[model samples]
Each structure stands twice: as C-alpha cells, then as structure tokens.
Target: MIRHLVLFKLNDGVVRDDPRVVEGARIFASLGEKIPELRFWECGWNVSDRPIAYDFAINSAVEDAEALRAYVEHPEHQAGVALWREFATWVIADYEF
Candidate 1:
C-alpha cells in the first residue's frame, strides 16, 4: 500500500470562509467518492493553532504506484487541484507501507 499525505497553507489574507475557499474545500471533500483509485481518504481543516500547522490536510492511501498515478491523473482530482491552486499552497509526501 501507499500513503499519500498533503498539507495545505491558505494564502495570505485569505480566510477559510471565503466563497472560493469554501467551494475548494467542498470539491476536495467529495473526491473520495468520486475517484476510484483512492483506497482511503480523509481531509479537513487543521484544528491546531500552532504556527507550524498547515491550514488543511489530506490523508489518503492507494494500492501502489500505478494506483497513485491514476489518482493523480483523475479528472475530478485535477479539478479539485485547480480550485485549490487559487487559494492555497501545499506540500505532498508519498511512501510505500
């Protein structure tokens, strides 16, 4: 199995309640049901107030490299990414388990 993790930081001056941010969050939240390659999916806003904490996160898993590739290329996933591009910046890590 592969674990895919992502941490997102909202852009300066942008709040989570902004209409665009809200829509972006909704899009990503729905990806688990929309993408078949996603074996596991959990995403949400960060609850901590620490300076090092990112604004959002995505914790997911897939079968393997091929499955990961498919998840990355999936159209619904791409659309969510596009929406996020406008409001946040993120980092990702993937590893075999």
Candidate 2:
C-alpha cells in the first residue's frame, strides 16, 4: 500500500473558520466516499498551536502507485486542490508499507 500524507498551512490572515476554508475541508473529508482508489482516508485540523504546526493534515492509503495516481488525477480531487490553493500551501510525502 502507499501511504500518502499531507500537511497544510493556511495563508496569512486565512482562518480555519473562513467559509472557503471550511468548504475546502469538507471537500477533502468527502473524498473517501467519492474515490474508489482511496483505501483509507483521515483528515482534520491540527490541535497544536505551535509555530511549527500545520493547520491541517491528511493521512490516506491507496492500493499502489497506480491507485495513488488515479486519486491524484481524479476530477474531484483536482477541484478540492484548486479550492485550497486559493488559501493555503501544503507539503506531502508518500511511502510504501
């Protein structure tokens, strides 16, 4: 399986409660149901307030690299990325297990 992880930091002045951010989170939260390639999905706001902490995170698994690619190219996923791109910047890492 491929474990795909992501950390997101909201752009300056963009709070989590902002409607756009909330909607973006909702979009990601719904992906487990929408994408067949997603074998696992967990995402949420970070509880820590430390300066090094990210505002949100995603931990997901897929069957393999092909499935991971499908999930990444999926239209719904692309849409969600577009929305978040407006208010956040993110980092990601993927590994096999």
Candidate 3:
C-alpha cells in the first residue's frame, strides 16, 4: 500500500471564514472519494494547541506507488493543486512498504 500525505499551512489573513479556502478544503476532500485509488481521507483546521503544526492534513491510502503517481498526474487533483498553491503553503510526500 501507499500513503499519500499532504500538509497545508494557510496564510492567516485569508485562512479562516474564507469561502475560497473552505471550499478548497471541501473540494479536495470530495476529490478523494471521486478518485478510485484513494482508500481514506482526513482533513481539518489547525488547532491552537499545536505549535508550528500544519493547518491541514490529507491522509490517503492507495494501492501502490504507481497509483499514487497516477493520482498526482490526474487532471482533477492537478487542477486543485494548482489553485490551492495560490493561497497556501502546500507540502506533500508519499511512502510505501
């Protein structure tokens, strides 16, 4: 199996109560379901309790490294990533065993 982990840090000014950011999160969450390779998904706002922690984490499981690669090249996820980069500090990585 493969684990696709993404962390996002949103700029404070445009982070909370912002429709675009909110929808962006929601849309990404929805995309996970639409994509067959995605075995799981989780997302949420950053809590004040954790210092220097990311605002959100999209934790997903896929069949293999190849499936994760396909997800990265998929049109829908690609579009969302492009749009999301404009407003947040995005970081991602994946691993398998």
Candidate 4:
C-alpha cells in the first residue's frame, strides 16, 4: 500500500471560514467516497496554533502507485486542487508500506 500525506498552509489573509476555503475542504472531504482508488482517507483542519504547523492536512492510502495515480487524476480530486490553488499552498509525501 501507499500512504499519501499532504499539508496545506493558507495564503496570506485567507482563513478557513472563507467560503471558497470551506468549499475546497468540502470537496476534498468527499473525495474518499467519490474515488474508487482511495483505500483510506482522513482529512481536517489543524487543531494546533504552533507557528510551524500547517493549517490543514490529509492522510490517505491507496493500493499502490497506480492507484495513487488514479486518485491524483480523478476529476473530483482535481477540482478540489484547483479550488485550493487560489487560497493555499501545500506540500505532499507518498510512501510505500
């Protein structure tokens, strides 16, 4: 299996309560149900206020690299990404287990 993790930092002046950000989070929150390749999914806003902490995070898993690719290319996933691009920047890591 492969674990896909992502951390997102909101852009300056962007808050989680903003309509676009809320919609973006909603889109992502639903991707696990919409994408067949997603074997596991957990995502949420951070609870901490640490200076180095990212504002949001996603923890997901797939069967393999191919499944991961399919998840990345899925239309619903792409739509969420497009919306996030306007308000945040993110970093990701994928690893096999």
Candidate 5:
C-alpha cells in the first residue's frame, strides 16, 4: 500500500473557523466516500498549538502508486486542492510499508 500524508498550515490571518477553511475541511472529509481508490482516509485539525505544528493533517492509504495517482488526479480531489490553495500552504510525503 502507499501511505500518503499531508500537513497544512493556514496562511497568516486565516483562522480555522473561517468559512473557507471549514468548507475545505468538509471537502477533504468527504473524499473517503467519494474516492474509490482510497483504502483509508483520516483528516483533521491539529490539537497542538506549538509553533512547529501544522494546522491540519491528512493520512491516507491507497492500494498502490497507480491508485494514489488516480486519487490525486480525481476531480473532487482537485477541487479540494483549489479551495485549500486559497488559504493554506501544505507539505506531503508518500511511502510504502
């Protein structure tokens, strides 16, 4: 399986409660049901307030690299990316275990 992880940090002045942020989270939360290639999905706000922590995170798994690619290229996923791009910056990692 391919493990895909992402960390998101809201842009300066963008708070978690902002409508756009909430909607972005909602969009991501819906992906597990919408994307068939996803074998696992978990996303949420970070509980820590530490300066080093990201504001949100995503942990997901796919059957393989091909499924991971399909998930990334999926239109719904693209829509979520477009929305989040407006208010946050993110980092990601993909690995196999």
Candidate 6:
C-alpha cells in the first residue's frame, strides 16, 4: 500500500467564505471517493498556530505507488486542479511507508 498526502496554503486574500474556495474543497473531498486508487481521504482547516494554516490540505491513502501515480494523472483530479489553481499559493508534503 501507498499513502499520498498533500497540503496547501491558499493565496493571500482567499477565504473560506469565497464560493470558489468552498467549491474547491468540496470538489477535492469528493474526488477522493470517486477515484479507484484513493482508499482514504481527509481534508480540513488549520485552527492551530502553524504557519501553514493559510493553505487547504488533502491527506489521502492509496492502494499503492502505481495507484498514487494514476490518481494524480486521473481526469477528475486534473479537472479538480482548476479549482485549486484559483487560491493556492504554496504546498507541503510527506510520503513514506
């Protein structure tokens, strides 16, 4: 099995109240369930004082590395990026056994 996790920090001035931001999150959360490779997915807001709080994050588990790769190339995920492009300024990550 493989785990795929991604975290994002939204661009300055972007807020949860914005319809675009809301839709982006919803679309990604749903995409996790729609893809065959995505076994688990969770997303959230950062209430902590961490510097990364400005970004939206996605943590997902996949069947394996191949599936993880496929997940990224998948059409739905590609389409999803369109929404992410609107507000993300930076990202963080961790991938391991």
Which regions of candidate 2 fall more than 4 Å away from where they truly are?
A: none
lDDT of 5 by residue, 6-95 (tens): 999999999989999999999999999999999999999999989899999999999999999999999999999999999999999999
Q: What is residue 77's positional error in candidate 1, in angstroms? A: 0.5
Model 2, TM vs. native? 0.98
For all candidates in order, the CA lDDT equals 0.95, 0.98, 0.78, 0.96, 0.98, 0.76
Question: Candidate 4: TM-score?
Answer: 0.99
What lDDT is reached at residue 45 by model 2? 96
lDDT of 6: 0.76
Residue 57 shift from truth in candidate 4, angstroms? 0.4
Worst 10 residues of 1 by lDDT: 79-88
Superior by lDDT: candidate 2 or candidate 4: 2
TM-score per prediction, in order, is 0.98, 0.98, 0.85, 0.99, 0.98, 0.84
1-36, model 2: which lDDT tens digit per residue?
999999999999999899999999999999999999
Model 6 residue runs over 4 Å out of place are 52-54, 92-94
Count of backbone clashes, every candidate in sequence: 0, 0, 0, 0, 0, 3
After superposing candidate 3, which stretches have Cα over 4 Å from the reference? none
- Per-residue error at 82 for model 3, in Å? 1.7
Per-candidate alpha-carbon RMSD to the true structure = 0.5, 0.5, 1.7, 0.4, 0.5, 1.8
Worst-scoring 10-residue span by lDDT in model 6: 88-97
Clashing pairs in 4: none
- Tens-place lDDT per residue, model 3, 26-94, is 778788677777777677666765777888778888888778878888888887787777788878888
How far residue 59's Cα lies from its native spot in candidate 1, in Å, is: 0.2
The local lDDT score (0 to 100) that residue 60 gets in candidate 4 is 100
